[model samples]
Target: MDSGGTDIIWNQFILGAALTRAARRVLERDGEEGEEIRFSYADTHAGGGGLPVPALLPVARKALASSAWAAAVGAGDVHPGSWVLAGRLIAALGGLAFEADVNDLDPAAITAAKASREGGWVRFWSHDWFLFLRNRLAMEPRPHFVFIDPPPDDPRGPGYAMDAAILLDTLGLPYMVTYAVDTPGAQPQEAIDQIGRSGLELRGAGLERGVLLGGGAETVVLDILSDLRNLAEVLGGELSVRLPRAPADDYCI
Candidate 1:
């Protein structure tokens, strides 16, 4: 993911859209149960919120023109990062949602997140991604949705992948994993294989022009997948849903 001063690429837009849709789904599902369903969110690599990413204006203008959240961005000079976008969604639900645990390895990013919020819908954390996950493991009434957007050059990518599997197995909370893809179809497949090898099933997966996303088992992910596919059509990009391949040894014997 890009830093606060970097240009906001297309991937951020896709991510914001996915988070928006997923949070809305959580609201719909949990709204009926009253206090039984507490909406919680976490972003492992949340960047600074409400930074200007001029590259995204054209796309954002098109995709979010009808969205009320668009006004939050003002004149389109600034864009919301995944955490801010999710926070906006939670804010929309009034006071029903729990304050999200938004963390970033960058202290500057954490500061930016803190500066952008008008209310207490989000909490900030400055920790290594691995340590952050370990701490969140003990959180009661686990996060309803966790967003994992590791930096492109992050050395802990492999470790994060492994930990993600443990997170799903142990907590059973849904997650949305997004990464940059150099090739059209290469990265998404690799993500599926990695998740499969980790012994978790994909709830939904999609490859948009420059970004790939994989989800854990939840209906919200399904909705997110559908929204991405629709966005692909609007952008004249391709969206492919790949199934996780079973372990080779499982079928060999």
Candidate 2:
């Protein structure tokens, strides 16, 4: 219910890990040789130490059992606590082969992330997140999975998120992006419609974390017609989606 940039909430962490795990599974299941996953997460607003280990522990456990699991990278604010937490998780959950790379544009945040952090699989970069991603994604065997959580303070405006959605479409990669849910207008739906029209697919479109209703939590899940479905289900289900029948010509609305 409380939406802010400071405190890390359970819904965001839990649901995000779940979605990441599921996407990892789906990717590995369908990937080619050595292409299972090299997961990278770029959050333009990586807040201070907030992501709890308890929430991500389960996800780590599930992923550790698989040989396809690989490294992870984080960009944006990437608080030091998160740097440590994420690094430990990847090493523990991903074993010795996996690595953790982190970055941020804020010099102070970078300083904070390295101030007390000890040696680990983690490394740091101080630069624009998109530039880091551009280089990272171009590496051998492109990122098998990417999660982009754009910052609220970005000077580029709301179109940044739209551009990211389109980037995922253009890159033709399996991705999960977090946007401002339940906005004051029709633009979110409009963007989603346009992205769907871009010949890519919508793996899932839901709240940053599901919302609570009188009876229970209400999550978003869409069917082929983009109609809401399963009002009572807990973790929210993903709809089956196919590529656009035509180019993005019908997306001007």
Candidate 3:
């Protein structure tokens, strides 16, 4: 999708494209330095299947070389659609199907996950995200990059646990976490201003409807590229992702 189009701001695929570009940039930098860097992916909130969004794995697969295949772990409602997509994408990328452990809390989602032939490569577990990761992370290789996309929630909304930043900060790993902050006026800017502190800094962000991420709704996406390396020169270059505001959709509220 071309950045020239105003519609791209609301298009979910832009996120995937941006991520793919970032992945390629990583490889290019590694190549330039005469060193190869490979990282795995761990995703929380894997979604209830049927992802129309562009596949991040495909782009990662397309770009990587030299120990290029990395493992992945995702936890979601299993939603059958979740495991199916993960398994296929891994296979398409020449990654071992066994490398992915996608779990869900619902028995039905688990059953759906297993029922799919893709289960052969996926470890679909009937476990909550917290419990699942506790055991999963201990087994062996831990994914280097974590992606968290929680459902839309107002910070003051009922049953709010914590923002993605706090959760990612607590994990103390490189992460890309996104949230939907439902507010009006300039409050979203205030939220972004408060995102970074001591050790963590914002690497990139997406905007929508003069807020963050997809228009018509208040969605904010903040990426903390890594704590493993200093991003000063890496991100300070001219290539910056700027998601301009789009016309609010009729469905936006």
For each of the candidates, give the backbone clash count. Answer: 0, 0, 1
Where in model 2 is the C-alpha error above 4 Å? 1-7, 18-44, 47-96, 115-120, 182-186, 197-253
> Can you write out model 1's per-residue Cα lDDT over 1-253, one digit (the tens) per residue?
2222212433444455555665666667666643534567788888777656554356645675664445444464566776666666656655355568888878888877788775546778888776786688677867767776666567665446445644563455666555444333234445455444212111222322233333533333444455455445444444554445666225211
Candidate no. 1 TM-score: 0.68
What order do you get sorting by TM-score, best first? 1, 2, 3
Q: Which of the predicted structures, 1 or 3, would earn the higher lDDT when compared with the native? A: 1
The whole-model C-alpha lDDT of candidate 1 against the native structure comes to 0.55
Clashing pairs in 3: 212-219
Give the winner by TM-score.
1
Location of the lowest summed lDDT over 10 successive residues in candidate 1:
197-206
Q: Per-residue lDDT of 196-240 in model 2, one digit per residue for the tens?
A: 432111123342432111000101221112221221122233322
lDDT of 3 by residue, 43-106 (tens): 4444444433223333322332121122222223222233344344334333232234665566
TM-score each candidate: 0.68, 0.50, 0.42
Off by over 4 Å in 3: 1-15, 18-40, 51-98, 117-120, 131-139, 151-164, 167-174, 183-191, 194-253
lDDT of each: 0.55, 0.40, 0.35
